[model samples]
Target: MDKTEILNNICYTKLVYDRINKKLKSNYSKTEIETLLFAILKETHEQDFQKIGKNFYVSNVRNNIKITINSNTYRIITVDRLIKTKK
Candidate 1:
């Protein structure tokens, strides 16, 4: 599929966008999210991902940025930040 088609196929909920904007303060635009999703799909092993349930997966894009998605639907459920503890 082309990049635009691939991007259109991936979905994100309103709550997910809100969290990314407000809580995470990432201000991630749709284009940025689309690029990240494309990267995840293209090279999943390169991204840090953990299976949380039968159909749910959480991927860490960066040290702090994380995204939870439904494997079955390919829908982004939430976005949040990982808290880092100082040694």
Candidate 2:
């Protein structure tokens, strides 16, 4: 499926947007966030999924992109880029 279609399947809450803005300070628009999420989900098999708690998952997409999600609600809790570690 296309990125837009993939994004349409997921849900996002206001808290998610707040966290993204506060944590990343990128001022990313909703469309931008959706696009990024689409890219991440598209590579599902390659991404890392960790169970943080009941019905909650943290998905590490690639080396940088990461997102926390509530499986039951399908709500995105947060989205941010990982800091690069020095080798």
lDDT scores for all predictions?
0.59, 0.63
Clashes of 1: 0
Candidate 1 stretches with Cα past 4 Å from truth are 1-9, 40-47, 59-61
User: Which tens-of-lDDT digit does each residue in 42-81 have in candidate 1?
Assistant: 5544335655674344445454556666666667776667
| Model 2: per-residue Cα lDDT over 5-60, one tens digit each | 33455788766776787877778898887776766765665325655564344455
Clashing pairs in 1: none
Give TM per candidate: 0.59, 0.67
* Candidate 1 Cα lDDT to native: 0.59
RMSD of each: 4.9, 4.3
